[model samples]
Target: MPQTIPKKKVRKPQKVGKAQKGKEEKMQPMPVYEKEKIPFRLRDKVAIITGGDSGIGRAIAIAFAKEGADVVICYEKDDVDAKITASEIEKNGRKYLLIGGDVSRENHCQKIIDRTIKTFGKIDVLINNAAVQTPQDELKKISAQQLTRTFEVNIFSQFYMSKAVEKYLKKGSSIINTTSVTAYRGSGHLLDYSATKGAILAFTRSLSSYFSEKGIRVNAVSPGPIWTPLIPTTFDAEEVATFGSNVPMKRAGQPVEVAYAYVFLASDDAAYITGQVIHPNGGEIVNG
Candidate 1:
Protein backbone atom coordinates (compact mmCIF):
# COMPACT_ATOMS: atom_id res chain seq x y z
CA MET A 1 0.00 0.00 0.00
CA PRO A 2 2.93 2.35 -0.43
CA GLN A 3 1.62 5.65 -1.80
CA THR A 4 4.08 5.50 -4.68
CA ILE A 5 4.07 1.93 -5.90
CA PRO A 6 7.47 0.27 -5.47
CA LYS A 7 9.09 -0.74 -8.72
CA LYS A 8 11.54 -3.64 -8.60
CA LYS A 9 14.51 -1.46 -9.46
CA VAL A 10 17.70 -0.76 -7.56
CA ARG A 11 16.75 2.54 -5.96
CA LYS A 12 20.23 3.94 -5.58
CA PRO A 13 20.23 7.62 -4.81
CA GLN A 14 22.00 10.17 -7.02
CA LYS A 15 24.86 10.20 -4.52
CA VAL A 16 25.43 6.70 -3.14
CA GLY A 17 27.83 6.84 -0.22
CA LYS A 18 29.12 4.10 2.10
CA ALA A 19 25.59 2.93 2.95
CA GLN A 20 23.26 5.52 1.49
CA LYS A 21 20.24 3.31 0.97
CA GLY A 22 17.14 4.92 -0.57
CA LYS A 23 14.45 3.44 1.66
CA GLU A 24 13.10 5.58 4.54
CA GLU A 25 12.69 9.08 3.09
CA LYS A 26 13.93 8.39 -0.43
CA MET A 27 11.36 5.86 -1.60
CA GLN A 28 9.40 7.33 -4.52
CA PRO A 29 6.37 7.84 -2.30
CA MET A 30 6.81 5.32 0.51
CA PRO A 31 5.63 1.82 1.44
CA VAL A 32 1.91 1.90 2.19
CA TYR A 33 1.75 0.93 5.89
CA GLU A 34 1.15 3.86 8.23
CA LYS A 35 3.11 4.11 11.47
CA GLU A 36 0.17 5.37 13.49
CA LYS A 37 -1.59 2.01 13.27
CA ILE A 38 0.94 0.45 15.68
CA PRO A 39 0.11 1.24 19.31
CA PHE A 40 3.36 0.44 21.15
CA ARG A 41 2.29 -2.99 22.40
CA LEU A 42 5.80 -4.38 23.09
CA ARG A 43 7.10 -2.11 25.80
CA ASP A 44 10.10 -2.96 28.00
CA LYS A 45 11.60 -5.73 25.86
CA VAL A 46 15.11 -6.14 24.47
CA ALA A 47 15.15 -7.48 20.92
CA ILE A 48 18.02 -8.43 18.61
CA ILE A 49 17.36 -8.58 14.89
CA THR A 50 19.94 -9.77 12.38
CA GLY A 51 19.64 -8.00 9.00
CA GLY A 52 17.78 -5.30 10.86
CA ASP A 53 19.35 -2.52 8.81
CA SER A 54 16.81 -2.70 6.01
CA GLY A 55 13.68 -4.35 4.68
CA ILE A 56 11.73 -6.60 7.07
CA GLY A 57 14.51 -6.28 9.64
CA ARG A 58 14.20 -2.48 9.71
CA ALA A 59 10.45 -2.68 10.06
CA ILE A 60 10.78 -5.10 12.98
CA ALA A 61 13.35 -2.84 14.65
CA ILE A 62 11.10 0.18 14.33
CA ALA A 63 8.06 -1.73 15.52
CA PHE A 64 9.88 -3.06 18.59
CA ALA A 65 11.31 0.37 19.37
CA LYS A 66 7.86 1.91 19.08
CA GLU A 67 6.65 -0.67 21.58
CA GLY A 68 9.29 0.39 24.13
CA ALA A 69 11.88 -2.31 23.48
CA ASP A 70 15.63 -1.70 23.34
CA VAL A 71 16.54 -2.91 19.86
CA VAL A 72 19.82 -4.35 18.59
CA ILE A 73 20.15 -4.34 14.80
CA CYS A 74 22.89 -6.48 13.22
CA TYR A 75 24.04 -6.26 9.62
CA GLU A 76 27.02 -6.44 7.28
CA LYS A 77 27.98 -3.20 5.52
CA ASP A 78 25.04 -0.90 4.69
CA ASP A 79 26.23 1.49 7.36
CA VAL A 80 23.83 4.15 6.14
CA ASP A 81 20.88 1.83 6.35
CA ALA A 82 21.92 0.61 9.78
CA LYS A 83 22.25 4.17 11.02
CA ILE A 84 18.85 5.05 9.66
CA THR A 85 17.31 2.11 11.48
CA ALA A 86 19.04 3.17 14.69
CA SER A 87 17.77 6.71 14.16
CA GLU A 88 14.23 5.46 13.89
CA ILE A 89 14.67 3.42 17.09
CA GLU A 90 16.09 6.43 18.93
CA LYS A 91 13.37 8.63 17.52
CA ASN A 92 10.89 6.22 19.08
CA GLY A 93 12.60 6.88 22.42
CA ARG A 94 14.15 3.43 22.74
CA LYS A 95 17.78 2.34 23.18
CA TYR A 96 19.33 0.44 20.25
CA LEU A 97 22.66 -0.87 19.00
CA LEU A 98 23.87 -0.90 15.40
CA ILE A 99 26.13 -3.91 14.86
CA GLY A 100 28.18 -4.30 11.69
CA GLY A 101 29.56 -7.75 10.77
CA ASP A 102 28.79 -11.00 8.99
CA VAL A 103 26.56 -13.31 11.00
CA SER A 104 27.87 -16.36 9.20
CA ARG A 105 31.21 -16.16 11.00
CA GLU A 106 31.30 -17.95 14.36
CA ASN A 107 33.20 -15.16 16.06
CA HIS A 108 30.89 -12.50 14.68
CA CYS A 109 27.89 -14.56 15.73
CA GLN A 110 29.13 -14.86 19.32
CA LYS A 111 30.14 -11.21 19.34
CA ILE A 112 26.65 -10.02 18.46
CA ILE A 113 25.16 -11.79 21.47
CA ASP A 114 28.01 -10.68 23.73
CA ARG A 115 27.65 -7.07 22.67
CA THR A 116 23.88 -7.20 23.05
CA ILE A 117 24.20 -8.52 26.57
CA LYS A 118 26.90 -6.02 27.40
CA THR A 119 24.72 -3.17 26.16
CA PHE A 120 21.19 -4.27 27.15
CA GLY A 121 22.08 -6.71 29.95
CA LYS A 122 19.64 -9.30 28.57
CA ILE A 123 18.03 -10.35 25.30
CA ASP A 124 14.26 -11.03 25.34
CA VAL A 125 13.91 -11.66 21.63
CA LEU A 126 16.17 -12.71 18.77
CA ILE A 127 15.17 -12.36 15.10
CA ASN A 128 17.36 -14.51 12.88
CA ASN A 129 16.55 -12.76 9.60
CA ALA A 130 19.76 -12.33 7.63
CA ALA A 131 20.07 -14.27 4.36
CA VAL A 132 21.44 -14.19 0.81
CA GLN A 133 19.70 -15.66 -2.23
CA THR A 134 21.61 -16.40 -5.42
CA PRO A 135 19.34 -17.21 -8.34
CA GLN A 136 20.55 -19.91 -10.72
CA ASP A 137 18.44 -21.25 -13.55
CA GLU A 138 20.60 -24.39 -13.59
CA LEU A 139 21.78 -26.46 -10.64
CA LYS A 140 25.38 -26.44 -11.94
CA LYS A 141 25.37 -22.64 -11.75
CA ILE A 142 25.86 -22.89 -7.97
CA SER A 143 29.57 -23.21 -7.26
CA ALA A 144 30.90 -24.95 -4.18
CA GLN A 145 31.79 -21.64 -2.59
CA GLN A 146 28.34 -20.14 -3.25
CA LEU A 147 26.75 -23.30 -1.85
CA THR A 148 28.84 -23.14 1.32
CA ARG A 149 28.31 -19.42 1.81
CA THR A 150 24.59 -19.81 1.24
CA PHE A 151 24.31 -22.37 4.02
CA GLU A 152 26.67 -20.42 6.23
CA VAL A 153 24.56 -17.27 6.10
CA ASN A 154 21.07 -18.51 5.41
CA ILE A 155 20.99 -21.49 7.80
CA PHE A 156 24.14 -21.84 9.88
CA SER A 157 23.84 -18.31 11.24
CA GLN A 158 20.61 -19.31 12.95
CA PHE A 159 22.32 -22.10 14.87
CA TYR A 160 25.21 -19.84 15.81
CA MET A 161 23.02 -16.97 16.96
CA SER A 162 20.57 -19.20 18.82
CA LYS A 163 23.33 -21.01 20.70
CA ALA A 164 25.01 -17.73 21.56
CA VAL A 165 21.86 -16.26 23.14
CA GLU A 166 20.27 -19.35 24.71
CA LYS A 167 21.77 -18.78 28.15
CA TYR A 168 20.12 -15.39 28.58
CA LEU A 169 16.76 -16.30 27.08
CA LYS A 170 14.02 -17.09 29.58
CA LYS A 171 10.67 -18.86 29.33
CA GLY A 172 8.83 -15.77 28.09
CA SER A 173 11.49 -15.06 25.51
CA SER A 174 11.10 -15.87 21.80
CA ILE A 175 13.36 -16.57 18.84
CA ILE A 176 12.00 -15.93 15.36
CA ASN A 177 13.89 -17.24 12.36
CA THR A 178 13.24 -15.98 8.82
CA THR A 179 12.44 -18.96 6.69
CA SER A 180 11.16 -18.65 3.10
CA VAL A 181 8.14 -19.77 1.12
CA THR A 182 10.69 -21.68 -0.94
CA ALA A 183 11.05 -24.00 2.03
CA TYR A 184 7.55 -25.32 1.55
CA ARG A 185 7.51 -24.88 -2.20
CA GLY A 186 10.81 -25.38 -3.95
CA SER A 187 12.41 -22.52 -5.89
CA GLY A 188 13.39 -23.63 -9.36
CA HIS A 189 15.63 -20.64 -9.97
CA LEU A 190 17.06 -20.38 -6.49
CA LEU A 191 18.19 -23.93 -5.90
CA ASP A 192 20.79 -23.25 -3.24
CA TYR A 193 18.78 -20.59 -1.48
CA SER A 194 15.70 -22.79 -1.58
CA ALA A 195 17.62 -25.62 0.03
CA THR A 196 18.96 -23.33 2.72
CA LYS A 197 15.49 -22.12 3.55
CA GLY A 198 14.32 -25.69 3.90
CA ALA A 199 17.16 -26.31 6.29
CA ILE A 200 16.02 -23.31 8.31
CA LEU A 201 12.55 -24.84 8.65
CA ALA A 202 14.06 -28.05 9.94
CA PHE A 203 16.26 -26.06 12.28
CA THR A 204 13.33 -24.10 13.63
CA ARG A 205 11.30 -27.22 14.35
CA SER A 206 14.20 -29.03 15.97
CA LEU A 207 15.21 -26.07 18.12
CA SER A 208 11.64 -25.63 19.26
CA SER A 209 11.51 -29.24 20.38
CA TYR A 210 14.90 -29.07 22.04
CA PHE A 211 14.29 -25.82 23.94
CA SER A 212 10.57 -25.73 24.59
CA GLU A 213 11.08 -27.51 27.92
CA LYS A 214 13.48 -24.77 28.96
CA GLY A 215 10.77 -22.16 28.24
CA ILE A 216 12.53 -20.53 25.26
CA ARG A 217 9.99 -20.69 22.44
CA VAL A 218 11.18 -20.90 18.83
CA ASN A 219 9.23 -19.89 15.75
CA ALA A 220 9.70 -18.79 12.13
CA VAL A 221 8.24 -16.37 9.64
CA SER A 222 8.12 -17.48 6.02
CA PRO A 223 7.62 -14.64 3.58
CA GLY A 224 7.02 -14.68 -0.15
CA PRO A 225 8.17 -11.91 -2.52
CA ILE A 226 8.56 -8.85 -0.34
CA TRP A 227 10.05 -5.62 -1.67
CA THR A 228 13.39 -5.74 0.09
CA PRO A 229 16.76 -4.19 -0.91
CA LEU A 230 18.15 -7.67 -1.51
CA ILE A 231 15.83 -8.10 -4.48
CA PRO A 232 16.99 -5.06 -6.40
CA THR A 233 20.66 -5.68 -5.78
CA THR A 234 20.61 -9.47 -6.16
CA PHE A 235 18.19 -10.04 -9.02
CA ASP A 236 17.99 -8.82 -12.61
CA ALA A 237 15.80 -5.77 -13.25
CA GLU A 238 13.23 -7.55 -15.38
CA GLU A 239 12.88 -10.36 -12.86
CA VAL A 240 12.56 -7.70 -10.22
CA ALA A 241 9.99 -5.74 -12.22
CA THR A 242 7.59 -8.68 -12.19
CA PHE A 243 8.70 -9.74 -8.73
CA GLY A 244 5.49 -10.03 -6.69
CA SER A 245 2.91 -9.55 -9.41
CA ASN A 246 2.36 -13.28 -9.63
CA VAL A 247 1.14 -13.52 -6.07
CA PRO A 248 -2.61 -13.59 -5.54
CA MET A 249 -2.35 -10.07 -4.16
CA LYS A 250 -1.06 -8.99 -7.60
CA ARG A 251 1.76 -7.11 -5.84
CA ALA A 252 4.62 -8.00 -3.56
CA GLY A 253 4.47 -7.42 0.18
CA GLN A 254 6.24 -4.63 2.06
CA PRO A 255 8.78 -5.23 4.80
CA VAL A 256 6.57 -3.66 7.45
CA GLU A 257 3.74 -5.98 6.57
CA VAL A 258 5.85 -8.99 7.41
CA ALA A 259 7.41 -7.32 10.46
CA TYR A 260 4.06 -7.33 12.18
CA ALA A 261 4.21 -11.11 12.34
CA TYR A 262 7.56 -10.95 14.08
CA VAL A 263 6.16 -8.53 16.59
CA PHE A 264 3.23 -10.81 17.30
CA LEU A 265 5.40 -13.89 17.71
CA ALA A 266 7.76 -12.04 20.03
CA SER A 267 4.95 -10.74 22.21
CA ASP A 268 3.29 -12.57 25.08
CA ASP A 269 0.13 -12.91 23.06
CA ALA A 270 1.78 -15.85 21.35
CA ALA A 271 2.86 -17.53 24.57
CA TYR A 272 1.08 -20.72 23.57
CA ILE A 273 2.59 -20.83 20.10
CA THR A 274 5.97 -22.43 19.46
CA GLY A 275 7.81 -24.29 16.75
CA GLN A 276 5.30 -22.88 14.24
CA VAL A 277 5.60 -20.72 11.16
CA ILE A 278 3.68 -17.56 10.38
CA HIS A 279 3.25 -17.35 6.65
CA PRO A 280 2.99 -13.89 5.07
CA ASN A 281 3.01 -14.92 1.48
CA GLY A 282 0.63 -13.26 -1.00
CA GLY A 283 -1.75 -16.20 -0.80
CA GLU A 284 0.75 -18.77 -2.09
CA ILE A 285 -0.42 -22.19 -0.95
CA VAL A 286 2.73 -23.91 0.21
CA ASN A 287 0.83 -26.53 2.24
CA GLY A 288 1.52 -25.84 5.86
Candidate 2:
Protein backbone atom coordinates (compact mmCIF):
# COMPACT_ATOMS: atom_id res chain seq x y z
CA MET A 1 0.00 0.00 0.00
CA PRO A 2 1.25 3.45 -1.01
CA GLN A 3 1.08 6.30 1.54
CA THR A 4 -1.10 9.20 0.33
CA ILE A 5 0.63 12.64 0.22
CA PRO A 6 -1.54 15.53 1.31
CA LYS A 7 -1.51 18.72 -0.80
CA LYS A 8 -0.32 21.90 1.03
CA LYS A 9 -2.95 24.67 1.40
CA VAL A 10 -1.84 28.03 0.09
CA ARG A 11 -3.54 31.20 1.24
CA LYS A 12 -4.10 34.05 -1.23
CA PRO A 13 -2.81 37.52 -0.30
CA GLN A 14 -5.60 40.01 0.23
CA LYS A 15 -5.25 43.41 -1.37
CA VAL A 16 -5.06 46.28 1.17
CA GLY A 17 -7.21 49.33 0.41
CA LYS A 18 -6.07 52.89 0.83
CA ALA A 19 -8.44 53.37 3.75
CA GLN A 20 -6.95 50.44 5.60
CA LYS A 21 -3.40 51.59 4.90
CA GLY A 22 -4.25 55.12 6.03
CA LYS A 23 -5.81 53.83 9.20
CA GLU A 24 -2.75 51.77 9.98
CA GLU A 25 -0.37 54.60 9.11
CA LYS A 26 -2.25 57.15 11.19
CA MET A 27 -2.31 55.07 14.35
CA GLN A 28 -1.68 57.22 17.40
CA PRO A 29 0.98 56.39 19.92
CA MET A 30 0.06 55.40 23.46
CA PRO A 31 0.57 58.61 25.39
CA VAL A 32 0.60 57.36 28.98
CA TYR A 33 0.07 54.47 31.41
CA GLU A 34 0.04 54.30 35.20
CA LYS A 35 1.81 51.83 37.42
CA GLU A 36 -0.10 49.59 39.83
CA LYS A 37 1.69 51.08 42.79
CA ILE A 38 2.83 54.67 42.92
CA PRO A 39 5.30 55.76 45.61
CA PHE A 40 4.12 59.38 45.87
CA ARG A 41 7.71 60.53 45.40
CA LEU A 42 6.62 64.09 44.57
CA ARG A 43 3.97 64.43 47.23
CA ASP A 44 2.59 67.92 47.73
CA LYS A 45 5.00 69.32 45.14
CA VAL A 46 4.09 71.73 42.36
CA ALA A 47 5.62 71.14 38.95
CA ILE A 48 5.33 73.05 35.69
CA ILE A 49 5.80 71.13 32.44
CA THR A 50 5.96 73.03 29.19
CA GLY A 51 4.40 71.12 26.27
CA GLY A 52 2.54 69.09 28.87
CA ASP A 53 -0.52 68.75 26.68
CA SER A 54 0.97 65.90 24.61
CA GLY A 55 3.74 63.41 23.94
CA ILE A 56 6.52 62.99 26.51
CA GLY A 57 5.35 66.08 28.40
CA ARG A 58 1.91 64.56 28.95
CA ALA A 59 3.47 61.38 30.34
CA ILE A 60 5.63 63.36 32.74
CA ALA A 61 2.61 65.40 33.87
CA ILE A 62 0.49 62.33 34.58
CA ALA A 63 3.39 60.63 36.33
CA PHE A 64 3.92 63.66 38.54
CA ALA A 65 0.24 63.61 39.44
CA LYS A 66 0.41 59.93 40.33
CA GLU A 67 3.38 60.74 42.56
CA GLY A 68 1.07 63.18 44.42
CA ALA A 69 2.14 66.43 42.82
CA ASP A 70 0.01 69.24 41.41
CA VAL A 71 1.00 69.98 37.83
CA VAL A 72 0.74 73.12 35.71
CA ILE A 73 0.75 72.19 32.02
CA CYS A 74 1.98 74.82 29.57
CA TYR A 75 1.02 74.12 26.02
CA GLU A 76 0.95 75.94 22.69
CA LYS A 77 -2.65 75.70 21.58
CA ASP A 78 -4.53 72.39 21.45
CA ASP A 79 -7.03 73.02 24.22
CA VAL A 80 -8.50 69.60 23.67
CA ASP A 81 -5.28 67.75 24.43
CA ALA A 82 -4.64 70.02 27.42
CA LYS A 83 -8.10 69.24 28.80
CA ILE A 84 -7.54 65.53 28.26
CA THR A 85 -4.30 65.72 30.26
CA ALA A 86 -6.10 67.69 32.97
CA SER A 87 -8.78 65.01 33.13
CA GLU A 88 -6.12 62.35 33.57
CA ILE A 89 -4.46 64.28 36.37
CA GLU A 90 -7.80 64.83 38.07
CA LYS A 91 -8.55 61.14 37.78
CA ASN A 92 -5.41 60.50 39.79
CA GLY A 93 -6.86 62.72 42.56
CA ARG A 94 -4.40 65.50 41.85
CA LYS A 95 -4.79 69.12 40.82
CA TYR A 96 -3.80 70.40 37.37
CA LEU A 97 -3.66 73.75 35.59
CA LEU A 98 -3.56 74.04 31.81
CA ILE A 99 -2.03 77.18 30.35
CA GLY A 100 -2.22 77.58 26.57
CA GLY A 101 0.36 79.75 24.76
CA ASP A 102 3.62 79.74 22.87
CA VAL A 103 6.47 79.08 25.27
CA SER A 104 8.87 80.68 22.78
CA ARG A 105 7.68 84.09 23.88
CA GLU A 106 9.48 85.46 26.96
CA ASN A 107 6.35 87.17 28.21
CA HIS A 108 4.37 84.00 27.83
CA CYS A 109 6.99 82.11 29.79
CA GLN A 110 6.82 84.70 32.57
CA LYS A 111 3.07 84.48 32.54
CA ILE A 112 3.27 80.75 33.08
CA ILE A 113 5.39 81.22 36.23
CA ASP A 114 3.13 83.94 37.56
CA ARG A 115 0.02 81.83 37.03
CA THR A 116 1.59 78.77 38.64
CA ILE A 117 2.65 80.76 41.67
CA LYS A 118 -0.82 82.23 41.95
CA THR A 119 -2.49 78.83 41.79
CA PHE A 120 0.01 76.53 43.53
CA GLY A 121 1.76 79.25 45.60
CA LYS A 122 5.16 77.62 44.92
CA ILE A 123 6.94 75.80 42.15
CA ASP A 124 9.01 72.77 43.15
CA VAL A 125 10.00 71.50 39.70
CA LEU A 126 10.26 73.01 36.23
CA ILE A 127 10.42 70.70 33.22
CA ASN A 128 11.49 72.73 30.23
CA ASN A 129 10.27 70.32 27.58
CA ALA A 130 8.63 72.34 24.83
CA ALA A 131 10.43 72.11 21.47
CA VAL A 132 10.08 72.39 17.68
CA GLN A 133 12.05 70.96 14.74
CA THR A 134 12.10 71.44 10.97
CA PRO A 135 14.16 69.02 8.94
CA GLN A 136 16.21 70.11 5.92
CA ASP A 137 18.72 68.04 4.04
CA GLU A 138 20.95 71.03 3.34
CA LEU A 139 22.02 73.79 5.72
CA LYS A 140 21.36 76.39 3.02
CA LYS A 141 17.77 75.20 2.83
CA ILE A 142 17.18 76.29 6.46
CA SER A 143 15.61 79.70 6.36
CA ALA A 144 16.47 82.32 8.97
CA GLN A 145 12.87 82.24 10.12
CA GLN A 146 13.08 78.48 10.68
CA LEU A 147 16.35 78.79 12.59
CA THR A 148 15.01 81.55 14.85
CA ARG A 149 11.77 79.71 15.55
CA THR A 150 13.66 76.53 16.39
CA PHE A 151 16.02 78.28 18.77
CA GLU A 152 13.28 80.35 20.39
CA VAL A 153 11.04 77.40 21.05
CA ASN A 154 13.72 74.83 21.88
CA ILE A 155 16.31 76.72 23.91
CA PHE A 156 15.17 80.29 24.53
CA SER A 157 12.00 79.16 26.22
CA GLN A 158 14.08 77.16 28.69
CA PHE A 159 16.01 80.27 29.57
CA TYR A 160 12.89 82.39 29.87
CA MET A 161 11.06 79.84 32.02
CA SER A 162 14.06 79.12 34.22
CA LYS A 163 14.70 82.78 34.90
CA ALA A 164 11.04 83.43 35.64
CA VAL A 165 10.77 80.50 38.06
CA GLU A 166 14.23 80.63 39.67
CA LYS A 167 13.29 82.99 42.49
CA TYR A 168 10.36 80.79 43.53
CA LEU A 169 12.30 77.50 43.46
CA LYS A 170 13.48 76.70 46.99
CA LYS A 171 15.99 74.22 48.32
CA GLY A 172 15.62 70.69 46.92
CA SER A 173 13.89 72.03 43.85
CA SER A 174 14.66 70.48 40.47
CA ILE A 175 14.83 71.56 36.83
CA ILE A 176 14.77 68.86 34.13
CA ASN A 177 15.40 70.00 30.58
CA THR A 178 14.36 67.79 27.65
CA THR A 179 17.35 67.55 25.40
CA SER A 180 17.47 65.02 22.54
CA VAL A 181 19.81 62.18 21.49
CA THR A 182 20.29 64.27 18.34
CA ALA A 183 22.23 66.75 20.48
CA TYR A 184 24.99 64.26 21.09
CA ARG A 185 24.97 62.15 17.92
CA GLY A 186 23.94 64.99 15.63
CA SER A 187 21.16 64.97 13.01
CA GLY A 188 22.08 66.04 9.50
CA HIS A 189 18.52 66.94 8.66
CA LEU A 190 17.71 68.53 12.00
CA LEU A 191 20.64 70.91 11.98
CA ASP A 192 19.01 73.79 13.85
CA TYR A 193 17.07 71.46 16.10
CA SER A 194 20.15 69.48 17.08
CA ALA A 195 22.09 72.64 17.68
CA THR A 196 19.37 73.83 20.06
CA LYS A 197 19.45 70.52 21.90
CA GLY A 198 23.22 70.74 22.32
CA ALA A 199 22.70 74.23 23.68
CA ILE A 200 20.15 72.81 26.12
CA LEU A 201 22.69 70.26 27.34
CA ALA A 202 25.24 72.99 27.96
CA PHE A 203 22.54 75.12 29.56
CA THR A 204 21.55 72.29 31.88
CA ARG A 205 25.18 71.88 33.01
CA SER A 206 25.78 75.59 33.50
CA LEU A 207 22.43 76.18 35.18
CA SER A 208 23.09 73.31 37.55
CA SER A 209 26.32 74.98 38.66
CA TYR A 210 24.59 78.33 39.19
CA PHE A 211 21.78 76.76 41.15
CA SER A 212 23.93 74.19 42.95
CA GLU A 213 24.56 76.53 45.92
CA LYS A 214 20.86 77.27 46.00
CA GLY A 215 20.08 73.57 46.40
CA ILE A 216 18.30 73.39 43.08
CA ARG A 217 19.33 70.51 40.86
CA VAL A 218 19.35 70.97 37.09
CA ASN A 219 19.55 68.06 34.67
CA ALA A 220 18.55 66.98 31.15
CA VAL A 221 16.77 63.93 29.76
CA SER A 222 18.01 62.87 26.31
CA PRO A 223 15.47 60.55 24.83
CA GLY A 224 16.20 58.47 21.75
CA PRO A 225 13.31 57.53 19.45
CA ILE A 226 10.12 57.59 21.50
CA TRP A 227 6.72 56.74 20.08
CA THR A 228 4.91 60.03 20.39
CA PRO A 229 2.63 62.36 18.43
CA LEU A 230 5.72 64.21 17.29
CA ILE A 231 7.01 61.26 15.29
CA PRO A 232 4.12 60.91 12.85
CA THR A 233 3.69 64.65 12.61
CA THR A 234 7.36 65.42 12.10
CA PHE A 235 8.43 62.69 9.73
CA ASP A 236 7.27 61.43 6.35
CA ALA A 237 5.24 58.21 6.13
CA GLU A 238 8.29 56.05 5.43
CA GLU A 239 10.26 57.69 8.24
CA VAL A 240 7.36 57.30 10.64
CA ALA A 241 7.10 53.59 9.85
CA THR A 242 10.79 53.07 10.67
CA PHE A 243 11.04 55.71 13.39
CA GLY A 244 12.80 53.78 16.16
CA SER A 245 14.11 50.79 14.24
CA ASN A 246 17.67 52.18 14.38
CA VAL A 247 17.84 52.15 18.17
CA PRO A 248 19.52 49.27 19.99
CA MET A 249 16.18 48.45 21.60
CA LYS A 250 14.83 47.95 18.05
CA ARG A 251 11.65 49.88 18.83
CA ALA A 252 10.36 53.28 19.84
CA GLY A 253 10.10 53.79 23.63
CA GLN A 254 6.84 54.53 25.35
CA PRO A 255 6.27 57.86 27.06
CA VAL A 256 6.07 56.18 30.46
CA GLU A 257 9.54 54.68 29.99
CA VAL A 258 11.12 58.13 29.66
CA ALA A 259 8.82 59.78 32.22
CA TYR A 260 10.46 57.87 35.05
CA ALA A 261 13.73 59.69 34.45
CA TYR A 262 11.99 63.02 35.04
CA VAL A 263 10.22 61.57 38.06
CA PHE A 264 13.51 60.41 39.56
CA LEU A 265 15.14 63.74 38.83
CA ALA A 266 12.20 65.54 40.43
CA SER A 267 12.20 63.28 43.48
CA ASP A 268 14.58 62.99 46.40
CA ASP A 269 15.93 59.79 44.82
CA ALA A 270 18.14 61.85 42.53
CA ALA A 271 19.10 64.45 45.11
CA TYR A 272 22.81 63.91 44.65
CA ILE A 273 22.52 63.95 40.87
CA THR A 274 22.97 67.38 39.32
CA GLY A 275 24.63 68.99 36.33
CA GLN A 276 24.03 65.68 34.57
CA VAL A 277 22.06 64.30 31.64
CA ILE A 278 20.10 61.08 31.92
CA HIS A 279 19.88 58.99 28.76
CA PRO A 280 16.54 57.27 28.24
CA ASN A 281 17.66 56.77 24.67
CA GLY A 282 17.09 53.11 23.96
CA GLY A 283 20.65 51.91 24.70
CA GLU A 284 22.49 54.55 22.69
CA ILE A 285 25.79 55.54 24.30
CA VAL A 286 26.22 59.34 24.38
CA ASN A 287 29.52 60.43 25.96
CA GLY A 288 29.22 63.69 27.95
lDDT of 1 at 22: 50
C-alpha lDDT of residue 215 in model 2 = 90
Tens digits of lDDT, candidate 1, 20-105? 47555654445555334445668888999999999999999998887779999999986999999999999989998989999999
lDDT of 2 by residue, 1-288 (tens): 999999867776555665556564533442233444546899999999999999999999999999999999999987999999999999999999989999999999999999998998999999999998888889899999999999999999999999999889899999999999999999999999999999999999999999997899999999999999988888899999888889888999999999999999999888789999889988988887
**What C-alpha lDDT, on a 0 to 100 scale, does residue 199 get in candidate 1?**
93
Instruction: For candidate 2, give the lDDT.
Output: 0.92
Model 1 clash pairs? 1-32, 2-31, 2-32
RMSD of each: 18.1, 20.7
- Each prediction's number of clashing residue pairs: 3, 0
State each model's CA lDDT, in order: 0.90, 0.92
